[model samples]
Target: MMNFHIHSTWSDGLYTPEIIVREAIKKKMEKIGFADHYQTTKVSSISKKYLKMYLEDIKALRKKYGEIEIYAGIEVDFSPRTNIDELPDFEDFDFVLFEYVQDSLWDGYPLWMLLDLRKRIKPPVILAHNDLSRNFGATDIEAFLRVLEADNIGIELNTNLNYTKLGEFYYRLATPIFERVEEYNIPISIGSDMHENLELLDDVEDALSFIQEMHLEKNLKLFLKEVGERYER
Candidate 1:
């Protein structure tokens, strides 16, 4: 299994990078990206300074740990786009992941603004999750999806989707967009987005099962082939 989006104690998560990578290696993950969240949206805050140590730690792990492939990345929101440049060499990382969750738990952002942000980001496996706005603003997500498709950004099929009333209904909500992406023959990556160590490997099967039941096997294979290559032993 491979997980490109993950968090550790460097951010709001519950473990250290070493522990996270250790567990990933134990679970036999082929490739994993430790993308801790960084601060964004401050009036004067120019960059995520906290990422310095995290990146260093991950890089050290990359050199020391030889069995698994570790990508040194930080998960930043699709806002505060100014900070992207503040980050050091993009070539150092295998890939990165981000989403459009600016408002409440809705997990979406303005498509036009997203398109604008895409122009600034250098290619590194750009991905967004389920399309739902927090303020309940009903916006057509096609605008952002189209731009992502055009720019060669791949969306993530996160298995940890919300399935309750309070939680945004991601699977059903994502059906149309997922179908649309498939119709366009765009690529996607599957992620556990594991916040904690255990949950890291917990939901891959469930997410795959949901998509399979929904009849997305071909899409799944295509997605795995693109993203899972790094995970192969």
Candidate 2:
């Protein structure tokens, strides 16, 4: 399995990059990524000065482990209070994930602001663990689709237990959007959002089940192909 959202000591995670790499290899994962936090508010965030060190560590892991793909990424918290100008350039990273986007938690920034931020960032922008049903389910679905398609932003199927509600995952609550994802040409990103455990690396079984139930093989393949093209992996 492939999981692009992971955390390490560079951020709030308990394990270091080398330890996480070893664990991922043990799990026989096809691909894994280290996406440490980069938010301005979070204490776990990696500062701009340490960005080079984080990238170098991931680069070293990439060279050391030829059997599995290691992607270097960062997870940003999309909050209204965050100063977008203070964030570093994202050209060096393979991808970037934004959390609390359009959600009640953290008083997330509006979708329009996120779109504006996307225009400035160079890497692919993905919404991490978004409460799609709560956020987009009540809004104008068509306009939302138009913005996602125009900006080429992807949404993630986060396999975190907290996302479960009423005996179903949050992504399951957003069937309307997933049903028409193909129509809008929007990509779907899957991740376990492993913060401290290497064993949880690529543990996206629930996400896989959701994709299968929704018959999103075509969409999944499209996302993979787009990522490959974007990162030249």
Candidate 3:
């Protein structure tokens, strides 16, 4: 199994990167990525000075545990107060995750703004735990898919319970969007959004089932291929 939304002590998570690596290896995970918080908020974001250390720590873990693939990533909070322009360049990381891009309650920046920001960042950018069904359900599906394709961005299937509403996962609620993804062959990412729980390191059984139901094998294979290529470099 593969997951790319894990958080460790570098941010607000309870565990450290070493512990996370140990847990993922114990679970027999094929690959995992560390995406600690990078919010502009002073209390929530990782300090700028720690950024280099964070990447180096994950890279070291990647080498030590050659048995499993490990990636360095960050989860950026895109809100009205957060300036995508002022954010640090992320070209060196394996991937980047954006959260609350269209949630009004959280003062999220719109998808259009994110599309513009996507052009500046170098690594793969994914929308994290978004309620897309609520945010983009009424918009033009084709247009949305076009922007995603043009920007080379991926949508995340978050397996975290906090994103569930009406007793269904957010991804399930966003059927129209994903249907278009299938039609357009856009890449998709899966993240358990693990914060404090290492026991559920790669526990994404439900997400796996959903991917099969949606016939997203080709998309997933493409994503994995890109990740492998990035690692090779």
Sort the candidates on lDDT, descending order. 3, 2, 1
lDDT of candidate 1 over 1-233, digit per residue (tens): 77666777777667888888788888888777776665666222214564566667887888889998777655656554435445444434445566654444433454455455556555355554544333222546576556666765665667665432356445445565555555544555556767655755535665566566655666656654554453332
For model 3, residues 1-233, the per-residue Cα lDDT tens digits are: 88988989988889999998888888889899889988577336676677888889999998898989998889888985566677887877888888998889788889988887777887878888989988888888898888787888888899998889978999999876776677765678888899887766877887788889888877777677766677778
* Model 2 CA lDDT for position 123: 75
lDDT of each: 0.59, 0.82, 0.83
> Which stretches of model 2 miss by more than 4 angstroms?
none
Best by TM-score: 3
TM-score of model 2 (CA atoms):
0.93
lDDT agreement of model 1 with the native: 0.59
Candidate 2, residues 146-165, lDDT tens digits: the string is 89989989888988777778
RMSD (Å) of each candidate, 1 decimal: 4.7, 1.6, 1.4
True lDDT of residue 194, candidate 1: 70
Model 3 lDDT vs. the true structure? Answer: 0.83
Candidate 1 vs candidate 2: the lDDT winner is: 2
Off by over 4 Å in 3: none
